[model samples]
Structures are given as structure tokens and as C-alpha cells.
Target: AIFSVGVSQLNASLAHRIPAREENILPTFRKALDLAREDADRLCHWISQDVSEDDFINWVTGSVRRMWGKKGNREVQAQFESDEGRRSVFDMLINLAGYSMKTKDILKQCDRVVEGAVLMRSLLKKVSHN
Candidate 1:
């Protein structure tokens, strides 16, 4: 109860910062996180109405990294320990919020599935001919 609220408040607070400098992998990661986060909020809209995938991912990712004694944040790594120390990290993705395999890969997979089905059917035809 209290913990949940504390985490929520932390996310709400972080949301405003929206790092502008852009990390190297932010494009794909941010997009996936945003989508996943949106879906999560939509899922939770009825129950207290204040949860997002972004929040969950950040919380989990940040917490896990902190626990491992390895921040894993690029910003933290780069600065070593300066004012910009926070900027080095790529947002943690514990929630696994968004992005499912790339589109091109998915299409190729679908194509393979179709090919497999066709091959199976052809195998049946050969068996019948024999």
C-alpha cells in the first residue's frame, strides 16, 4: 500500500525530467517502453487508475541494478561521479513494456510458417500418390 504509492510518486516525479540529450539506444527502447507503458496504464485504468509500464519498468530495472551493486547506467559509468552522473543510464526495462521482435523479422517468420504449412501439405500429397 504505502510502498506502491511511494513508487508511483517516484515515477510521477521522474516523468517530468524526460532526458533530452538522448542516449544511443533510446530510440528503440523509448518507443517500446512508451507503448508498453501505455498498454499497462490502459490495463490498470479501472483499478485506482495510476500505473504505467514506464513506471513499472523503471522501478524494477532501477531497483534490480541498484541491488546488483552495478548501476549499469551509462551516465553513471561515464561521469564516474559528477553532477551529470545520472545521465549515463539507459532507462531500466524490468516491466519489459513494449516492442516485440522487429517487424522485418516477424514478417520473415510468418513467411517461414506459411512455407512450412505448404511443405507439409505437399508431403501429404506425395504419401497419397504412393
Candidate 2:
């Protein structure tokens, strides 16, 4: 979810910079955008599933390079290599994993607490009957 927000921000940032009449460039830009979102979702999944931090970071670094690498349309590639693009990627790498993991842990703890409360309530009802 956090990654989705980041992607939205990225899309908005890119949309503002790229001119509308550059229809030729838009396809490449859209493809890159789709790839980025997919990568972010995969990374988020890895984080929530308890992938090692070192492994996660390694994948992110490599993925960013591949995504923004020199092989694509020069204009598209240059856009991704720009400061705004780098910043967005950086934010995702630094914050996304940590935030996802923290959220997963918090949810787990909440579930356990709720389960305990339910058990306690059941026990209390039995005791009250006695």
C-alpha cells in the first residue's frame, strides 16, 4: 500500500515533466511505470514475508539499476536517472521495507492480543456461571 502511494507520487512527478504531445515517449514511460509498480509490489511482499534485510536491499539495488538502466529509450532512461526519480527510488528502498515489516509485526501482535482477549472472555463467562 505504501509502495502504491509512492508509485502514484512518481507518476504525478513524471506526468508533470513529460509533455502531452510527446505521444511517442508516452508508451515507454507507461511501460516503465508499470514495471516500477510491479517491482515495488514484489519488494513489499518480500518484506512482509520476512525476507532478510540484506537480501531485500540487494534485490532493490539491482532492480533499480535494471529498471533505470541505459538500455531503454534515452529520454525515458534519463528521466528515471534524474534527481526526482532517484529520490523516489531511494525513499522506496529505505522506507518501504522497514515500514512494511513494522506494519506486519504490529498486525501480528494485534491479532494475538485479540485472540487472548477472546479466550479471556470465554473463561470469564464460565467462571461467572459457576
Candidate 3:
């Protein structure tokens, strides 16, 4: 759960650069950002379906671990915790901000990464019961 939000925030940070510096990264960032938005939606859906906070937390944590496990994007996954994880997130945020997005909304977007994590937790709880 924490990790998903971190990656989304990192994706935002890494995307703020102008094309002249490294044009290739822009497209990757675009794809990454799209995925991040999807994650947030998933979070909202999970939250809507659930009733227990502890179950929700475990679900988000476990779901994120499983998803990242399959995807094998360690750098992306690490953003949920650790020093390097945070550094990467900061780098992405800097990049995104450079691209002229509103600072406040961007921060909110970064923070909103938690929403996906929350949703992931909810989904897992549902799965375990069935």
C-alpha cells in the first residue's frame, strides 16, 4: 500500500524534465503516470467495498507486495520505504514539477498514492474470505 503511493509520487517527480534533456524518459513517465491513476481508482473501489481498517491495511500491503513481485520493478516497488526508495521518489517529483504542473495538485496527487494502497488492502481481504 505504502509502496504504490511512493511509486506514483516518484513517477510524478521523475517526469518534470523538459524533452531536450532526455526525451525518451518522458514517454515512460507518461505510461507510469497512467498506471498510477489506475491504481488510485482501484484504491477507491477497494475502500468502498470494505468495513474493517486492520483488514484493509493488510490487504493493501500484501496486494502491493504481490503485484510488485510479479511486475519485478524493484526501483518502483522500493518507493514505499527505505532511503534509496525516498530518493527515487524525490527525483521523480522534481522531474514532474519541472514540467509546469501545479505544485499543490501535484503534491495532493503524490499523497493520494495512499488511496490505491488502501484499496489494494480491501481487495485482498475480500479474496481471503472467499
User: Residue-wise lDDT of candidate 1 within 1-130, one digit each (tens)?
Assistant: 1123333544554576555335534554555566667656744542232323343334334532443235333332223233322221122111111111223587755654554344334333333343
Q: Every model's Cα RMSD, please?
A: 24.0, 23.1, 18.0
Best by the lDDT measure: 3
**lDDT against the true structure, each candidate:** 0.37, 0.44, 0.46
Writing each residue's lDDT as its tens digit, candidate 2 over 26-78 gives 66567667878788787665434432334333433443334434332242223
TM-score of every model versus the real structure: 0.20, 0.24, 0.29
Clashes of each: 4, 0, 8
Instruction: Give the TM-score comparing model 3 with the true structure, all chains together.
Output: 0.29
Point out where model 3 deviates above 4 Å: 1-3, 6-20, 50-128
Q: Positional deviation of 112 in candidate 2, in angstroms?
A: 34
| Candidate 2 least-lDDT 10 residues | 85-94
Model 3, CA-based lDDT: 0.46
From the highest TM-score down, the ranking of the candidates is: 3, 2, 1
